[model samples]
Target: MELTWLELFIIVLASFRLTRLLVYDQITQFIRSPFFDEVEEEDEFGQKETYLVPKNRGIRGFFGQLLSCHWCTGVWCAIFICALFFVYYSIAFPLLLVLAVAGLASIIEVIVQKWLED
Candidate 1:
């Protein structure tokens, strides 16, 4: 069966949203795990000292870590599937347009995040 660009966009977006909801806590814990790698003790300033965990990823480990990064994995899968769809339909412009929009959105998101952090 043939699918339109809009349909593909909806499918990918919806899949990402669903996976996000399901994996939120695991994702959060994965993010927070780095803090635990340090020796939890008092600093000279009487505050806590912590160190960031350096994750080691080699070959299979790299792919495993990537697979565990839920949102990134979702986006990667979605892009691959969209690329396959484009190849099947022999439509280059639509894929390029989608990638362009994604890039714009990423830039906007980075700007918004920076603003929020300030």
Candidate 2:
């Protein structure tokens, strides 16, 4: 198998989507669980308020963080693919394929976000 940037990008994108479809909902439930929520103060006045701080469960955040997630996944996938490219030829090809799937997933996520906004 030949390692190529395009292939890697496709793999990552696909992984991202699969992760979201297959895993995000369950993870989101866990994240939104009462345990994940915490109270915080706005100022020294001791005004307390509850906030939902999302847990970092990798692809679980899928559509959770919106554009930020898309960008983060995209950038991260690209970097990892590049690194793998320089690592091992055998692993590089497979890794690139995975990264490519993830990359495609990110693109789809971005598109969905835009549609939602409209």
TM-score of each: 0.34, 0.36
In candidate 2, which residue ranges exceed 4 Å CA deviation? 1-39, 43-80
The CA lDDT at 22 in model 2 is 32
Q: In candidate 1, what are the lDDT values of residues 44-114, reduced to their tens digit? A: 89999764332465554554455456767677756765666556545654554565465456557879999
Deviation (Å) of 35 in candidate 2: 20
Each model's lDDT comes to 0.56, 0.54
Our tally of clashes for model 1 stands at: 0
Best by TM-score: 2
Alpha carbon lDDT at 23, candidate 2: 31
